[model samples]
Target: MDYIKLLFALLLFLVGCAGISPKPLSIDQRLAAIPRKDAPLEHKLIIRWNEQAVPYLEAGSDADLAFGLGLVHAHLRGGQLALLKRISQGRISEMAGPFTTKVDHALRILDLGRAAPQIEAALPDETRRWLERFVEGMNYYQANTPNTPPEFSLLGISFEPWTVRDVITLSRLVGADVTWFAYFSLLSERRKGQTDEASWRRLIATTQAGAPNFRAAENDSQLLHDLLRASGRSGSNSLALAPGRSQSGGALLANDPHLGVQLPNFWILAGVKSPSYHAVGMMIPGVPIFGIGRNPGVSWGGTNMRAAASDIINISDLDPAGFSKRSELIRRRLWPDAKREVRFSSWGPIISDAELLRGGDGETLALRWEGHDPSDEISAFLGAARAKNASEFIAAFKSYAVSSQNILFADSSGVIGQIMAARVPLRSTSGRASFIRTLDEAKQDWSTHLATPQLPMQLNPQKGFLASANNRPAQTNLFPSSLFSDDERVKRLEELVLSRPLWRVEDLVQIQTDVVSRKAPALRDDLLSFMPDEATKRHPTFVTQLKSWDGSYAASSRGALLFELLLSEVAHKVYADKKGRVSNAASQWSYLTAYLKTDLSALEPHLCKEILQDALDKAAKRADRFKNWGEMHRLPTQHLLARLPILGGRFTLADHPASGSRETVMKTYHGLERGLHQTSYGSQARHLSDLSDPDLNYFTLFGGQDGYLGSQNFADQVPLWENQQYVRLPLREDVVKAEFKRVLVLPN
Candidate 1:
């Protein structure tokens, strides 16, 4: 009887541990559980949605088109837009909880919100009115739409009226990401203790291109770390062909802005038309104009012009009178009584000691970011959207003040041009210095900027082709403080362009997705020469694979995978600096390729053969795990909700097998900090514009436009984008109206 009682007690404990089961619903009940909404169109404006739900807005005026853009943007990406505004305002913790408190703190220090009102007040009346109309449209969408994205309901947050300041804030956020202030900070710290000044200068000259700068070291706190990680590491490709070089007797332009891959892509496809003009391209959600696209006969696209627009100042004994003190109450949903005070000097916001080190003489450090200063980039893009020809487009480039970009222009008149548009700081006479270590030294910095004429620009170059892959604009006259990308991409681009005589738009697209690596063949030759008889006998399969490789990182090529692994291992063995906490040599292809081709005496002592043999054995093992390269080289499209176990799988775009290594023109690059072959960064958007037929302009995004889960358009582009397919971005209004499935009219 006692044994029976014990068994019964054990069963009860088991049942209790199991917990109550969640209630299950039948199919009928599940069908009925869907959320209902009543969203009707207003009468003032007309919106036509394509089969993919991309909106085409036709308004009586430009302001109305702005209103329509805001309305559609709010409906499709309300959650993302709201979150961006919240983050920029340093109010993310109010909705996202404690995890984002650090992000909030960093944003508060950056203080784009404080600078927004002043920026808005000083804007031209035309730009200001357009922004106002955009705000009204967003507000109207919020009032009329009965339902919001599931994320809002899950977080228990509601959308608020977006102000024009929010638009300015978005631009500031973009500027912070693309700016290189934190890059110089890390480079400065890394270059410390180098006694040989000449060697240091030479090292700067050699390694400045492709710094391989990551977000931050693992030990870093969230503030400086976030700043380092803001822009993340990215590269781009852009080119234009003159009429003489084109197969169709018209110019062609191509661009693919490489950015951190994400779902609900950083851009949205939109077509806006008013009586004044027509524009179409990938529009950042909050901004009114298409950042890279065409209007009528003119088409334009850009790459981040890696300009030196930010600086870190070491303040030795700052005067309190020259600054303002404020306390930012970091509101938290989870943590209570969390408040902190921070100070800002005349230079900029002071970096906290916890985030970065203070000077030795009881000094603080401040960051003077050019983005905080008021400038008008929005007006420039708006003007560009209305530009009809090459000269008009070049005129629009003159007013750009904040962000730097390499603009490529092609028009109906057979003209091709390039503009290095940026608010380039007129550095002091000694501005060639990479580090400005004293606050007094940087006090009068950026006092003057390069005038529009001073900016490097060319129209119809005699070469018949112009290209920029974030490379040095000119061999001699580069921007004084520019940190250009590695020259390999540009060199390879020139080879491909020069090799071809008569180019077509299709040929340009082929170049955009080209996977041939210039360094691979030479490296393969070196490995063959280094292989000993013993290695050749033991690793015959590896030797055979290496010999058979054509150097293209095609998905089926196992040799490409093996070579990438071998290269990474060799880099680790060769450039592992004991003093520098991080080694960036592995990701710097130009440096590594150059080093490998040099004499054996140049290599680390006793490492050349030893490292090669070890890498071969490891590669053999790694090779066995995968049937081919496609199985190993995967592109992981991480989503914000991917952190959640249940929702993660649902939100993430399908992990597709990606081709191309860091050295390829297809150019999917990953950091050495992460595991090799992990596709973290690559081209997020690709465009091929044909001047022969403007309506035939084709482009693709890594993902689709919609951010909402229920929307079919969400993640719709992934399959085609992965397959290197592009959809038409029709320029004609009649075609757009015919392709659309739904029409929405807004009340004026």
Candidate 2:
């Protein structure tokens, strides 16, 4: 009897463990479940898959191609697609349970889908037909396919049909103003009592100094932007080389978009051929357009313009009766549905009603974002994908409304250009540095808007190369906010571009992976100069390493680790307030370094020396804990599900040594954690296209092509990304047919 009881206990334990980490179906198992020989379609469509699981869809008509793409996307990333739709619609709580209530509340307040219905109504007839077919394909897959992704059952997600509104909503989600990140960071600091006028002025000045110009030649909370980052929205780096600067004598384009490090990357690799669209490149899973890709006439990429498309307006003085209120029912998986009230003002939504803005201290604030207005990003991207020249491409984005971008292009004509693509709100008062506006000011300031031709643009600059890395353009007056990234990445790109007279596709690849930091060396030199003699004598080995170190943040770099630790210590000491709390404004490395350079020089001689010595001592103590930079700076390739207790480790795709710093051209952003730190944001996908040959396009995703958990292709492309290698996706039909062997046929 005792033996039987013990056996029963062990059996129950094993079953519970299995339930925690439920195994997903194999790729073969999932694919076998789907009908391969035929499908419900308007025309015959052929789908071919490469060894890496990248799909190439060929169809008789544009609508059919759209349907085929929807089928392929659903087959590979059905779970991700479902989750994203829920997120965009503020319905995640219905699937994930009570923990996501706050998230749903925030999303409801932001109302990402506010303009979706209007945008859909205004869509061109052709685009609408394409979108409807895509929706049909997705619904067909969901209805017929069996053995779907395991996450669906685990999360209790219903297999809902896809809609055009869902696509528009997802676009808005991706284009959530990046400026909100700056706003949240600044607001958090203000909540910490750093709200004095002098502090605000100093912070604004330091931020402005970091902006770089392309023409010249240039959050932490579970806030909306935080959720956006988790849903894959972040910065990027893009460069275009005119024929004169290219070794191939053909224009070349290189792009690497940055996003939070996670499994099942935000992008999918695919090629589509149809009457209206013939392009090969990356596409956001739910969105139908190819965001970064190359067509027969041009290759293109983009970086976020960091446009001030929204403003936080203080409505504290406004009458409460004027506010509009609506009740939203938030359903949780295992709990009773809760009704929450969402308030809105004439300006926009009362964003302060969300926990994200609870720090507003009794003040009521509404967020007036350009995304709330009716606009068609779908038409803009579709137009861009079909554009045959620089002028057409520029005109395509004339009505682009939000998530502004520096759209860079390299055309078949060897013409390279950049256009600021966004409908920016023109402030009534020029040079308004504060992100927060008074209610009266908000009503008047944002009355006018600027579109494509009115925004700053450049065509074939004298330098023969154009690049954007979230830098301020040459015309600062055109943008309302100066919260741009420091010029480290852009400056490095310019250096590499001008390093030689001409460049090849291979050279651009090298530039993309370059980890050298110009700011690091400059900051190191400044620190060394201020170091006390006694401190250097005490830590001879540390001083020697710093002196001999170049600014390369390679995996094996010991000097890089030491420099980072020292910088963190120095920043803390320099920016600490009277209460010993360091300002969040200095959290930006560029601002910290700039502030230190100026402050160190102006400080009393003895005080500067003392601070330097103290910082060195602290850094040396921490440096003793790590063997090299890679040991401390790691890339966290874990899915959000990794937060699940005991089985979390199973969800982690990879946590390995990584190179690059916050400001390096190859960005892997880390903070001032004392010992080991994991990088949360960095390059997630890379694309390079040489217009010389139809087969010269190369691409790689930081994660993989397939989003299925147990699929062998899930993280297959990670090695290629890490090694700076690429998969050649050719536009030539013969080459594509020869390369992709696995096939599926869909018949009308």
Lowest lDDT 10-residue stretch of candidate 2: 211-220
lDDT of 1 by residue, 440-515 (tens): 5575555676745578787899999888887666543434543556666777888999997998887677788888
What lDDT does each candidate get?
0.66, 0.79
Candidate 2 per-residue lDDT, tens place, 34-132, comes to 554457666778888888889999999988898888888888888788878888888877765665677788789889988888899988898898788
Q: Where's the lowest-lDDT run of ten residues in candidate 1? A: 16-25
Model 2 whole-model lDDT (C-alpha atoms): 0.79
Q: Identify the runs in model 2 with alpha carbons over 4 angstroms from their true place.
A: 1-30, 36-38, 191-197, 207-220, 223-225, 577-581, 602-604
TM-score each candidate. 0.86, 0.93
Best by lDDT: 2
lDDT of 2 at 665: 84
Q: How far off is residue 471 in model 1, in Å?
A: 0.7
Candidate 1 backbone overlaps, count: 9
> Candidate 1: misplaced stretches above 4 Å?
1-44, 177-203, 211-213, 219-234, 352-363, 428-436, 439-445, 476-478, 524-533, 577-582, 585-587, 596-600, 603-607, 644-647, 673-677
Residue 675 alpha-carbon offset, candidate 2, angstroms? 1.3
